[model samples]
Target: MVDEMQGERLLATTEAVRLIPMRHSEARSGRRASGDFVPFPVDTTMALAALTRQFADSGKPVEVTFRKLVHWIRSGERSSHYLHPYPGKLLPHIAHFFLANGTYARPDDTVLDPFSGSGTVALETVLSGRTALYAEANPLGRLLTAVKTHPIDTAGVAVALEQVRGSFAKSRARKPPEVVNIQKWYSPAVIAQLVRLRAAIDALDAGHQRDLMLATFSAVARKSSNADPRFSVPVRYRPGDAPARPAPMELFVSHLSANCARLATLGLIDGLGEAIGAGNDARSLKAADGSRLADGSVGMIISSPPYAGAQKYVRASSLSLGWLGLTPASQLRGLEERTIGREHFAKASWGKQHPSGIACADALIAEIAKENPSRATIVAVYLSEMRSALTEAVRVLRPGGHLVLVIGDNTVCGRRFASSEYLREMLEQLGMTVVLSLVDTILTRQLMTRRASTAGIIATESVIVFRKD
Candidate 1:
């Protein structure tokens, strides 16, 4: 129900000084070097030279103004998108608007989303006849995206559901998974039933049926668990705050049917192009055939990368990951360490103390670190990883091609952090020119984050567009 309020447009600006060579805080702090904060300037120089050669006229970015971005929460996401809800999931209409607009005007073009959570961008790409590359890090996200985008075998799905339901018809004894603190998240009854459903789905024939069934299981996994669906982390109930818990079977059946029905609208579109979904770290993205977007080949790069200290996918998806057997409870520690924004590695063990070469991020990191050293380390680690991934994004994009990122700022430890502005600086350093930066209102912040921040809780997010040229 969110509509555009008014029309105001502005272009992003960056000072070259933002890319100064800085000391590794980890080195300065006398800690062991993790090399996670290294930023190579030669790559930036080459990228900029390439861009300069591509656009000789201004060699600067072209800015566009938009008065509206449609509804950021619920506008064009009325179909299969509702099958699974994700924490801080991107809006479908936002992707559609970018695709429909001049950012990527050709339907035969190729699009990429490095952090393709739930495949919002990929789905929009194929529906518009354009192919997509969805490189995601989370296995659960990979499974959901694969099932959501591929053409469902309606008959096979039906048979699989019957088989799944029939297997559990005998009311056999069920044991909860021996994963980290299962009892804290689910009651004995709920845990037993969810495990039964998982075993049933896993035994099914290998095909889209099992895929769809697993997706359904993931979609409904939180229904019976203490995992707080409202936020990224599964929060247990507080004392005297017992929330209403539904039965697992009821949630699975209804959600599965709804997902199947919504998918019915898509016809066979295998010939239009390919919508490839690969699970890997966005920082090191690639295609299924070990292919990358050849240098200067991509039409547009669209994604909403992980926010710094904002969204934690590892903690958010623990229940389903354990249930799906993707990451066992004991092994989750390793996964958290690898995840972009996770607080797995201690600040003392951090490789860097300052944000990598971005002046704005460095200043903010310094300010936050002044209050709490731990928060500063978090900011530095998050931005360092982001710079690497974004640099790769620029490398694959064709000169003059636009890279549109949907991002919001953060207020950690009660300090204002300009996330989009910092991202703009990083892209600029990676040889990208800022085209347009539009601010849009968010209608559903409550569902996106567990608790509101003192800094207005991301009341607005910006769509920062950059061009390789």
Candidate 2:
């Protein structure tokens, strides 16, 4: 939580630099530039302006080749991307690079993101003046994407926010939703504040405005909890050992105000193509109307798929899930199992080994199973699921459209798991021709600097571009 005095200083400093042009990394890192320190705050228009500065440079001479593209783009995010906090989001520049480049996809063309984690690709697509189509397995991610891409009525949201603020004291505390080990995650005072805030938010008419408030509430739900802030996954601190934090309602109001400003800035963009959310599963992508996606319908597809047993997206979202009343604690495992790269499996399914059909992948699985059979099964399942997802991606992409995948390698059972290689082989078998493959050094990521014993630091990521034959 931001301290009150510090928050005031931040607000003042943000207002001062609102007109200055700053680099993406410089603004984010709070580096001293031209003898003035610019720190990243929750201010909305400044962030929007900083991101737009990158787009303004589109007129400069540039080539589309990988070597030229690498230097042409930089990591930055639009204001809407800050509407919610999501783990392992693809850097906005990567998606912007593909969408803005006329060779891969042009304005008004439709782009699809099957994984759509937090709608990074979708937001970028819309900003590039292309229609954005996406499907996300996690309900929280889907909701976030929906809110991020849509334009918000700032005046209406502000009135509603004030009403919510006034009603908090009078709002009755509703019974908390069923969350596993709830006591370990939140204190009584925090829970009371959250439930009351939930009640107030529920009173509003159901629409985009309500969704904006809900997204803000969800962010507060995570920030005000006992979970350790350093780690992506929830790690509860011992009772009374947790540090002091801001009140839940205070956090909600501050975040909602900032988010509203962000949405207003997003609304300034003209001719932003619509962002549509397809159904949950990537293996069988569909349209928002529940219609099947026709073959060769999408002009391009871009995604950074979940790695094999490396991320715990479901677990990371469990807190928000319960607070939003989307899923109860008991059903989290079921939700986890449904995702592509889950580590857990039923005992019956574990007994049988499934081959990914790639000789090298199967060989690696066999080598892993010699020591930990269950871990090996996780790897096999990950590969199998990705194959299905990729098949669907290829099925919907236009013949000449490109499929750009940003993936990285990780360790499984203490051995190197070449996931990027496996994906390339799988795409090839599906008849997709590899066009360009570039490896990027990861500067910072959601995962710990040193990951758990089984997984090591993912130092680099491979960006592979493929075209359907």
RMSD of each: 15.2, 7.9
- Model 1 segments more than 4 A misplaced: 1-77, 170-173, 238-246, 268-273, 291-293, 446-456
Point to the candidate with the largest TM-score. Answer: 2
Q: Mind giving the per-residue lDDT tens digits that candidate 1 earns over 1-469? A: 1111110000001011112244444122211112222111111223334333544556443232222322222344343566576767776656766665433445456888888977878876765557788887778787777777776756566667667777866546476665567878777877888888888887787877688888889767776777655555777766767677557876777666667765543433333335786447787767677866467656888898877766767777778788888888998888877777765567565535544787767876777766777767777888888888888888778877889898888777787778887888888878887755556666775324422432336666777778787
Clashing pairs in 2: none
**Highest lDDT, which number?**
2
lDDT (0 to 1) per candidate: 0.66, 0.76
lDDT of 1 at 371: 73
Model 2 agreement with the true structure over 205-302: per-residue lDDT tens digits = 89999999999999999989889766778888766778887898778767876676566545555555688987899998988789998899999999
What is the RMSD, in Å, between candidate 1 and the native fold over all Cα? 15.2
Instruction: Please report how far candidate 2 places residue 250 from its true position, in Å.
Output: 1.2
